[model samples]
Target chain A: MRGITITLASLLILTLISVVFANYAHGYMVFGILILAALKFIGISFCFMELKKAHSFWKVGLLLFLVLFMISVLFLAK
Target chain B: MESKILNHKNIYYPPGGILIWIIIFLELITFGIALIVMVFYGQKELEIFHTSRLQLNTTIGTINTLFLITSGYFMARSVSYLRKGQKEKSSLFLKLTMLGGLFFLGLKTIEYYFKIEAGLTVGHNTFFTFYWMLTLFHVIHVIVGLVILTSVLVGLRKNPSKVAIEDVEASAAFWHMCDLIWLLLFPVIYLLF
Candidate 1:
């Protein structure tokens, strides 16, 4: 519980910082920060969703899903 | 049987079972495609996308993201406590999780009302189209998630032991997916250009 709380707090603080930065960012910086957001999404799934303790199938499956999602979102954003 | 074999060792089994994992993966793919398509369309009208994003309330989106994430934390703890056989503590945490969802829904209603009053309906423009469709769909998911959690709460009172572990884990998994999707949706629909 402590670990999860700390992780959530850290992610929130980092997300706020990233959001503020992304708001004003231009060029590649925008997508870069969005990628940070994607990472946070994956991190939350791993921790909060208990995917860390889940089977290898799920661990691998989620990783692939998010990777493809991030790639598609970023690649198609232009 | 294959089912028994799969569920036996539990080494290769997902928490909520293979069915929910399949559902989660399928849902992720579906939303990923939808969002990617929306962004692809958005690029053609960058001017409208940028301007429309400004009308969105970033603070509210941020708040909801925090709420969902906190709720997710509570949910994970609830499952952990339940597995530990702490029924009362688990029930309390689950209720907290539901409260967070209610807060999110109330704020989202206000945000929608503000948008609708401002004439930002789906047909108003392309960007609003994407905004309304994605977030409304997500809102439905949240509602369903709440229903699932409510069922869990009720079942806990009747007989926590009688409730299948898969059922609770499935609800927990669905709730986590809501948080995950909102985290993805918030920046794209509310913040990004």
Candidate 2:
């Protein structure tokens, strides 16, 4: 419960930052914002979805998916 | 043996189940491809994309993001409550989660109503095309999620003891996946412009 609240609050903050500079933020700045989104994604998966009790392989796979997907989409955006 | 893999206290199977995650990954890939294609089109028609993007309500998108997150939080609370054997509290949270989803749909409908009134439709332009496709598709998922949540709630009420933790967690996993997809979409579709 505490963890979910903290994650949502942090995500809201990151979202505010991203929207404030939506026009000007470029390249790595955009990537950084997306990385934050991915972080929240991982957090929800672990804490909310109860992936913390999941197997090691699932955890590693999710991390790998986040990294690879973010990098690919950013490249495509570029 | 088919219920859920639980032997020596180590999780070999996923929270919801292996099947749901497979469905989730497939859904993500579908949305991902659509988004990538949208990006490529945006590059080609940058002016049209930007102009159409300006027509969208960023505030609404932001609010919807909060709605989804709050609903997800309620879902997590429900799961925890169930784990503690608090069926009634868990049931209340499930209803709250569904309320969150319904509110999101209400706001989304308002946004769409304004867009349609302003001469923006799926066939309006490339940007509107992507807008309708991505968002409407997402709306369908939300509906599916509501169904999933409703079923889980009913199951809990019928027989909380029979309601396995894996079963509840599976429903929760599907709900959170909806949240995750929107989180990915909210930034890229709404704010990235």
| Candidate whose lDDT is highest | 1
Give the least accurate 10-residue stretch of model 1 chain B, judged by summed lDDT: B1-10
Q: What is the DockQ of candidate 1?
A: 0.59
The sequence of per-residue lDDT tens digits that candidate 2 reaches over residues B8-52 is 124447777887878777877788778778877888888888788
Best by DockQ: 1
Per-residue lDDT for A48 in model 2?
A: 75
- In Å, residue B37's CA in model 1 sits off its true spot by 0.7
Listed per prediction, chain B TM-scores read 0.93, 0.92
TM-score of each predicted structure versus truth: 0.93, 0.91
Worst 10 residues of 2 chain B by lDDT: B1-10
Which whole-number lDDT from 0 to 100 does residue B119 have in model 1?
A: 94
lDDT per residue (tens digit) for residues B5-62 in model 1: 2351255467766777787778778777888888898889989988998899989988
* CA displacement after TM-score superposition, residue B22 of candidate 2 (Å): 0.9
